[model samples]
Target: MSFHYETPLVDQSELAQARAVMGAGMARILGYFREDGARSIRAIEEAFTQGNAAAMVIPAHTLKGESLQFGARRLGGIAESIEQTARRCVEQRLAPSEVGGEVAMLRGCFNETLALLESAAPPSGTPRPPMPGLAGTRPVTFGTAPRTFGRRTG
Candidate 1:
């Protein structure tokens, strides 16, 4: 079954709430989300490649929740589709190929979602005003160097 998102790709309200709750910690959390989402996407793609329907569940499920945490509805919806379809395929002894197309689309959705998220995220490695007690100490942000959002092969 195909999925369409009724909501925006990224929900600003959810992000705003997260930012309000987390304050400056939002950058670190976004960094964690970026890393974790990529790893989970890789796992899901690898499982699909290996024809392991069972292996697809965890990563897809992980991606679904984490995507929602960042207000990424489209990515979360695609991931949920993968997770549910893979689970059904496993139960029915169907090949992972049943869910192959969605699996193939997963990374693209993730990249799109990441682009939106990164746009909303504070710039990593950019200098910020020093904290009250720590003069001349630039706040450290966690994340890799900026990427072009291109899908990595291999």
Candidate 2:
């Protein structure tokens, strides 16, 4: 069965609201995201490689919170899914193998989110370009291939 991923690249209203509170600090926040986001992604992969399903929760949760803070709702949602799946794997006594599908889904979402952010590059030193209404929507295409840990298979 196919799953329809409907979350957008970012939520403009949420970003605008955050911008109001953060003011000029928004630039630094985006910069932190740019640096730490990739690190968190890599951390998730590393956790998978170690066959530690529980370890996935930390990075995924961290990414989820950070993504939400930066108004990247879709990315945050995907991260949240990863976190929940990891917890479920533990709670239901499922093997790490059982998490393969969710991991693949997260990878696809992460890749999509990264591509959108990269393409929307603002001028150097400028904060991330706030994606407006319906501006970041792209056709969702979930991959079926099973991605193995320790390798960038998606």
Candidate 3:
């Protein structure tokens, strides 16, 4: 079955912020996935399979944070669930199957997110003007307040 994502996973306004932060370094940002995303995904999956809940949680959380910063809404949404599940597992000693399910869901989410990002045209030669509320902003910090409308801040 297809994974169902919560609404507002990606906000168009956030895309503007991401483009502004990249500031002609868009290629470099996308390159991270081309180079190391696969490895990171594998590591996350491996951690989940091994029942290393903490490891799974850590990577998922990192991915979620990064994805949101980059305005990768789809990826961020999936990773958020994985992060939550991992957290729950760590806190309450959940079953391995539960973690496994979350990991599987995460894999699908990654694939879809990657596809969506790839399909989008790269940032234009002349960077578009930053969106309102995002102009003159600094790069987003991990686990900080969400910067877009329709998304939970903090």
Number of the top-ranking candidate, with TM-score as the measure: 1
* Residue clash pairs of candidate 2: none
Candidate 1: the clashing residue pairs are none
TM-score of each: 0.72, 0.64, 0.67
Model 1 residue 94 lDDT score:
79
What clash pairs does model 3 have?
A: 145-154
Which lDDT tens digits does candidate 1 get at residues 1-154? 4555464788888876655555566678777888988999899888888888899999899889988887788888888888998999899987788777777777777788787777776655544444346777776886775555678634
Q: In terms of lDDT, which candidate is strongest?
A: 1
Worst lDDT run of 10 residues, candidate 3, spans 1-10
User: With candidate 3 superimposed using the best TM-score fit, by how many Å does residue 12's alpha carbon deviate from the native?
Assistant: 2.2
The 0-to-1 C-alpha lDDT of every candidate, in the order given, reads 0.78, 0.70, 0.68
Error of 2 at 45 (Å): 1.0
Query: Quick one: ranking by TM-score, best first?
Result: 1, 3, 2
> Which whole-number lDDT from 0 to 100 does residue 112 have in model 1?
80
Report the C-alpha lDDT of model 2 over 17-64, residue by residue, as the tens digit. 766555556665666776777787787877777777788888889889
Error of 2 at 93 (Å): 3.7
TM-score winner between 1 and 3, please give it.
Answer: 1
